[model samples]
Target: MASRSPRTTIFLLLLAVSLPFVCGCTDYGGQGVEQWSSDIPGGEAGDAVFNTPVQSAFTGEDESGTGFALQRIQPVMDGAAATEPRMFPVKFETREYEIDIDVNRSVYEGARTVDKALPAEYWYDEYRMLGYYSSFIGDPAIVTFLDDVLSPLERIRRSDNLNDEEFLELMVTFVQQIPYDSGAPVYPRYPVEVIYDGKGDCDEKSLLLLGMLSRAGYDAALLLFPEMHHATAGIRISTNGNPPFRTFTTSKNEKYFYIETTVPTYIGLYSENYEDAEAFVVPLGNGEKRFTRVNYVCHITESYQKIADRLVFMEATMAEWKQEIEDMKSDLQYGTYDTQDAWDDDYASYTALVGDYNSYVEKYRKYAEIYVYIRDRPYDIAGVYRRIENSNVMDITI
Candidate 1:
C-alpha cells in the first residue's frame, strides 16, 4: 500500500465500478534497477537486493563500507500471562471463517522496544532505511512470532481442502481485512505489532503479508516505489493460462506478480496509480510455493472486462438512436415532409428506430446486472464463472 491521495471514482453505467480494470501489460517501473542509488553507502547504483546480515545483537559496521549490520530486537518478558487472543473474522465467498491468535504481552512490548531511527551517518539515506525495513521480514524472532496466527490459517486450509491459490487468497484477504490506519508510525512495524494494534498503513500491511507468504513457502518479495513512497507485496505464480495484472522480473529470473494489501482486491489486481511507476523488488525468501489457479481468475477478469466494454458501446449506440427519433418527431410536427407518402415513410423509420432503441435499453440493463455481479463479487470465483458462463454478452445487439 503506497501512500497516495484519495483514489478517483470510476463510473460504470447501471453500476458503480470500484476495482481498476486490468491493463494486461507488463511494466516494472524500471528493469529491477536500484532507484535508491544515492542512499547506498558507496554512492554506487547497484541492484537492490538484501545483502545485510541478520543478527540477534546490534553491531556497527566498520568504516571500510563492506556491508551493513542490523540489531535483532527480542521481546522482554516480565513472567506474566499472555494477553487475550485477537480474533480475525474472514469471509471467503459465502462461508464465514474465524482465526484467533493469542499475543504474548512481552512480544508486543518487545516490538515497541525496537528502534526505527537510522544511524547518524545514514540518517539522510532513505534507501538504507528501506534496507532496514527489509531486514524485519527475515528477522527470525518476528518470523517465529507470527506462527501463532499462521497455525490457524494452516488448519483452515487443511480442513477446507483449499488449493494453493485459494489458500493464498485466504491469507491475502485476511491481511486486507485488517483496518488501514495511516496514522501508524512512518517506519514499518513488526508483524506482531500490526496484529496487536489491529491496524497498519500500506507498508505495515504489505510487510505483514510478505512475511506470512514467505513463511507459508510462497516466493514473495517487497515491491518498493521510491517515487510514490508506496510499497506492495509481490508473489511468483504460474502464468501459463492468463497473465498477471502487472509483474516485475528480478535479475535472478524470478517473476513476481503485484499484490495490493491495503484494499480487498483479488491477487492479480492492483491500483492504476502504480501501474506505470518503477518498482524495486526485494526478495524475502526462496520458497518454492507457487499459485497455479491463474486460468480460473483469468476467466473472471476477462469476462468482467468484456461486459464493461459492451455496456459502454451499447450506451453510445442508444444515445444516437434516441437523438435520431427526437429529430424525426420534430420534422413531423413542422410539416417538413413535402408529401403525405414521404411523411408516412419518415414516420415508419422513426417508429422502427424507437423500437430498436427500447430493445437495446432492455439488453443494456441485463448486461449491467452481470457487470455489477462480477464486479462486486470478485472473490466468488466459482459464482462469477457461472454467471459469466450462463449469460452471453453477444446477445446484447448494438
Candidate 2:
C-alpha cells in the first residue's frame, strides 16, 4: 500500500516540472489566429462538409497557384468515430439533447517539414492545435497548474469537521466553475492554458479537472464518448452504488462516476443519451492506458477506505502529540515538579516530544500526497495505443 502507483509517479514528475508554470504563460499572442469553420446552425450535423478538404491559402490552379490539398487524416484507430470525431449532449437543462461535433477541422493532423518559413497562420493553428497533439501523459506544465490549484484544496484533507463526501463535492464544484469557452479551438486545452486563458471546451476543461483531481489525491480519468462527439472528466468513487449514469470499472473492480467537468452537473445524473454510450476511460499518465468499460456490477471501496484509515490515524496521533506538548508547558509554568533535577529531566522529555511531533507532521504530509496519487489510480490497467489514437476529441471517422 505504501508503494507509489505508476500514475502517482507520473503525477509527481509532472508536478516537479509544473513548479515553473505557477507563473503561467498568458495570451497566445501569435501573429495571426487560425479561423475555424464549423456548422453554426444551418449546416447539417452529419454532413459531407466534414470530409471536404479545407482549401488553404497556399492552394490554387498551379499559377492558379493553389497548393495541393494535404492528406490530413488516416482512419481513426477505432471504428466508433468513423462518422464523426466528437458527439455530445448539449443542453443539460433538458437532459435529452446531444451535440453533434464535427472534429473534421484538422489544422495539424501529422508531422510536417517546414520547407519555407511556413506561415504565421499555421503557427497559430499549431498553438491552438497543441492541446489536440498532446496525450497529456505526464506533462510538467499541466502538473504545475494542478499543483497550484490543489495546494488550496490540500488543506481540506487536514481541515476539521467535514464529511467524507464534502471534499469530492468541492472538487467537482471547483472544476464546474472553470469557464466553458465555446469559441476556443476544437481540441483539448493544456491544463495551465486553461487557467491562464480563463476558458476551455469540455476536452480542455476535462484535462484541467484531471490534473487537479490527480494532485489532490483522487482517482481521476478522462472519458471520451465518440458517438456523442464529447469528452468529460470523472473520478473513481468507492462503489457502483444505486444506478445512475455510466461508470468505468477497472480490472480490480473500482467504479468511477462520469463527472462532467464542463458543466456543474451532478455526479450520477448524466444526459440520457450519454447514460448508455460506451466510454473509453483513460487514467491520464498511467503507462499503457488500458480502458476499463462501464459496468453495473461489482466495485471496490478499498481506495476510499485506505485513504480514510491513514488520515484518521495520522490525525489522532497529531492531536495526542499537541496535547502532550501543551501539558508539559503547563507543568513547567506551574512549577509542578519542585526539584531542579526533576525539572531538567521533564524539559528534556518535552523537547523530544516536540521533535516527534514535527517529524510526524512532515511524515503525514508526504504520506497523504502519495496516498492521493496511488489510490486515485486505475488498478491493473495495461495496453498499447495506436499511432494516432483518439484521446480528447474524436478523430474523424473515414
Top candidate, metric TM-score: 1
The lowest-lDDT stretch of 10 consecutive residues in candidate 2 is: 379-388
Q: Tens digit of lDDT per residue, candidate 1, span 298-358?
A: 7777777777778776666666666667777898788666689999998888888788878
Question: 51, model 1: CA deviation in Å?
Answer: 24
Q: Please, what is the TM-score per model?
A: 0.74, 0.38
RMSD (CA, Å), candidate 1 to true, equals 9.9
Off by over 4 Å in 1: 1-18, 21-70, 77-81, 118-131, 240-245, 323-351, 394-397
Candidate 1 yields a Cα-based lDDT of 0.64
Error of 2 at 356 (Å): 70
How far residue 217's Cα lies from its native spot in candidate 2, in Å, is 2.0
Candidate 2 lDDT (Cα, 0 to 1): 0.41
Relative to the true structure, candidate 2 reaches a TM of: 0.38
How many residue pairs clash in each candidate at the backbone level? 2, 19
